[model samples]
Target chain A: MAQNKVLLKDIANSLGVSTTLVSIVLNGKAKQYRIGEEIAQKVIDAAMTMNYSPNLIARNLRGGKTQLIGLIVTDISNPFYSAIARIVENRANELGYTVVFSSSDEELKNTKKLIEILLSKGVDGLIIVPCDGSEEIIRELHENNTPTVLIDRNFPNSDISFSCLNNYRATELATQHLIEEGFENIALIGYKTRMNHILDRIKGYEDSMKKAGFEKYIHVKKVNILNPQAEVHSALDTLIKKKNADAVIFLTNMLTVAGLYSLNEMNIKIPNDIAVVGFNRNDLFNLFYSPITFIKQPLEIIATQAVNTLIEKIKNSELEIKSMVFSEPQLIIGASSKKV
Target chain B: MAQNKVLLKDIANSLGVSTTLVSIVLNGKAKQYRIGEEIAQKVIDAAMTMNYSPNLIARNLRGGKTQLIGLIVTDISNPFYSAIARIVENRANELGYTVVFSSSDEELKNTKKLIEILLSKGVDGLIIVPCDGSEEIIRELHENNTPTVLIDRNFPNSDISFSCLNNYRATELATQHLIEEGFENIALIGYKTRMNHILDRIKGYEDSMKKAGFEKYIHVKKVNILNPQAEVHSALDTLIKKKNADAVIFLTNMLTVAGLYSLNEMNIKIPNDIAVVGFNRNDLFNLFYSPITFIKQPLEIIATQAVNTLIEKIKNSELEIKSMVFSEPQLIIGASSKKV
Candidate 1:
């Protein structure tokens, strides 16, 4: 087998120059090192021919910058988070940074481990959609001056910079739309969590119900992050049979899938039996027979802002920390939200 | 800022020991380094109290392994790829490796650049869903003994190990199901690609059509990797108008969305006007009113096999290269494929 790699020394040996001269020329530092132009050109040509790429690990060790960002999300398979990750990756790439991504699978331990692993791999910055019980880790990262930005969710105690959707306004608009469609006895189907975003969504639903003079019928389900389908089924069953909800607002993307499946299994006709509003835009919502109404968060803006903020922090540690950014969500009306 | 970081030197300064002694104790090399047991314990205690963590880049520079794997896919935002990525990361993490991911977006240049970037970063191994024109790079990787395993797609010229679904059998079974449903003039709507997996799917469709004695009609659409919706719309229109296709098999997950959207816009009912079969399982397929018939590849198995194979290669470069693994795909029948 051919030798695994061609190094700067190999280029130097082939070009009859010192390894330092080869490295200086290839790294575009030959002028500063006062190397002759002809020798520099010869070194560069030889390096290219030999495919002598610099070792990023060694370079990072010397420079203390890897030009790599670590991104952790609750779930990458979900369309909502996946969209954000894609945007973030694209923006980071445009800014000459590579992204290393991992899904926390909604586990605090996994999130913590992933953060530590990213730090160990020497990422220049981190963007995380934090799970619960991650405040301590985020606090440590903050104290260490590790350029980090939270996405989608944030801890109340950490004061970590974050980019998120206006969950309250999004849910408020969605709930008001249901009310305008004459849906009373509306039920909010959501996960039981202390997450600020989830709480804000529930609060939005309650505020809208109170303003509309309707009793709040909240059915918060505890979803197992590992296996959520079962919980979603039982939660929907309780809402429809026990609460007699005339309308249901799904508070998260995963919940919407379960709600739709449960409604289908129960043979409940959308809008006619129970109007529905979903929190995130899914292609299924558009392709479904009765296209479901959904709130589409500005994922592109959120991702871009998060990347930009993290990059700025990485570039200049003394930069002023920006306030949290909350982009507006647009309500897309579909037949599922039509008046009874 | 609380000293930004706690280093070995800080631990040593606080404990009145050398930095080397602290590192030796922390790395569990105290016995090999011949340090006193009590002194080692002291160093460990002090290191813990000081919260000292090893600089991974510097350690990797010395150890020659970063314990990081680079995963490049066509699009991370797509659920199919995202599912694969999630499993890959999980399995890699279990084996004490962190995965860094990038999306090639089906561009040759991007894929090449990503491979180079990963190599520069000193990743121990790579898992890539190969895009076209990547054969040269893969060949170089193979020559250099850079542990790599292609996923989802493979090149004909390269002997790179790959893990992929049985695309031929999957499409054959899906097409046969549609044929059994008595649909003639079936059309295959897919992105035009030279990828082996894609070609196999097309060939499978053609073989099944030939066996059924139906004239083959294929509409290979040129989908824009960045924006495929518009192309999907036009391709579906062409299939319906020019080819008079009564049934359509979507070759990939993303194409299924576009096909369904086009069918909806054209007011074509599933199984009534035109039957549909989608390759790759999607959550939407289960949630759609007329749930879609799709081929579900064993994602976990594929991911596990790919990661295990890559890890094995990384651990023992002299290990025998395994033949390509093709896991079977299951045909999931739904209302979309019911006979009219």
Candidate 2:
């Protein structure tokens, strides 16, 4: 890495100028220091020709500011997380920071390892979409005053700063929409995890069903994330065959995709056989035999707020400011959830 | 960032062990240096209690190895790129390296800037999906003997190591498949760029049409990658209306998704009205009225090979080893392109 390294002294010596003057001009303080434009231009040209690049690693060690943000997601290939990652990367870039990312694979050990790796790399802050059962590690980060912002999911009854979807109202909107379309015995397909987000979605669906006086028919099927496709298939099979469910709501984009695959395999007709609503939208939904209805989480808004909040935290770590931002999710109606 | 900094000397002082002994033990060379197990255990316990984390940035400045890989893609959120990114991330991790990613946005300026930023950060190697007109910048890197492996796209007549799909044969298989399906006027939808991948697909379609004695009916529609949706819509409109294309092949996943939307809006039926084949597979394709036939590029193979090749370059930069790996793509036959 240091084969042809160039230093400020080399540039200054070649130009017959002081290294201090070259540094001042290159650092964009020449006007304040009353340096002539011609001298600054000469310094810039000489530096470019010499291929002089500031050593950010050494600078960070001395100054303790890396200008790097670490981003951790469940999986980078997942469309929902990928979309958020792109928005965060763009917003962080605008804030004069670069983001390094890793996927936790929804494992607690991986989350801890990733955090340690990011910390060792000296990232100024972190924005994480935490996996289930990662609260203790996150709590430790909070205790150590690490500038972190949780995204998509956060722990219940914690003061950690986060920007997430209003999961409760989102599912209520979907469940209520299905009920209003004259579908009874509605079921909610969700991940069988203790994640607060999934729990909130279940509560929202159960509350909606109970409020509609269909408490006896309130059916909630939770699928393990690891075996989602097969579990979703069996769940849908039971819901349609034995449970006699006429409508179903998915709690997440992954679940929605799995449920759609299962329904398709079962030769079930959407809205006619079983009404459907999903948590997030995918482009493939548009070309579906019946376009999918979804609760479109404001991904851009959530991601941008997370970046902005994390930057604020990094800039003002001494200040005891913890903010939790929850954006509303819009229910997009399509043929899948409409009346037959 | 250094409020509660922990040092090896501090741990030594606390545990009454020499700093050299502490360093050796913490670095996992206790047995090599014949250190007693009790002293090593004490040092490890004290270090853990002190919350000691290695400073990778400083070590990298001295060692000239960051153990970090920089991945630059067209867009991180695009499924094709994201899928490749995830594979690269996992494979790089297996090789004991972490990946930091940035999107070039298909702009030469962005690609150059991203490369500069990644280099400034002192990444050990780079894996890039080059943008059109980015050949000069890539060539500069090659001349500097930088460790870089281009993925998905590469410059023609360059000795740069790359792992890409056999784009020519991929589209030829699709075009030839349509010909076998009794479609005379076969059209190809592709990006209007000097990118070798897109150009190869166009050439493949042309050659296939000419060989089939349908040269006069070879309809090629090139769209702007910047304005893909609208351009794809207009391209499909012209192909179906003016060009009288009975079958169409998409060069990429994005073009395929956009073409599906346009065809659906125009109320064109697949196979019966116009046959369809796409370049990549997406989960949403399964739910379409006629599931799309696609040439599925082996994303994992390409991404893993790029990481492996880049690491090899990094480890042996003095060696003049230039390897180009081209993976054969599979043409998945679906209901979209079938005989009536």
Please, what are the lDDT tens digits per residue for candidate 1 over residues A1-340? 2336787778878877788888788888988989999888888778777777777777788888999999999888777888888899999989988888888888888888888888877889899998877888888888788889999976665568999888889889998998888888888876667788888888888888889888555444566655667887887788788888888888888888878888888888898888889878888898776899999888889999999999998988886575589899999999999986
Q: What is the lDDT of residue A23 in candidate 2?
A: 88
For model 1, the superposed segments whose C-alpha errors exceed 4 Å read A1-53, A215-226, A319-322, B1-53, B215-228
Instruction: Show the lowest summed lDDT stretch of 10 residues, model 2 chain A.
Output: A1-10
TM-score of chain A, model number 2: 0.91
Among incorrect, acceptable, medium and high, the docking class of model 2 is medium
What is the fnat of candidate 1? 0.79
The lDDT values for all models are 0.84, 0.89
Error of 2 at B171 (Å): 1.3
Which candidate should be chosen as best, given DockQ against the real structure? 2
Total clashes in model 2, counting residue pairs 3 or more apart in sequence or in different chains: 0
B1-340: candidate 2 lDDT, tens digit per residue: 5337787789999988898999899889999999999989999998888899766777677765778889999999998888999999999989988888999899999999888888877789889999999988888888888888999987779999999999889988998999998999989899989999999889988999999999999888889988699999988999899999889999999999999998999899997889999978799787788989999998989999999999999999889779898899888999989978
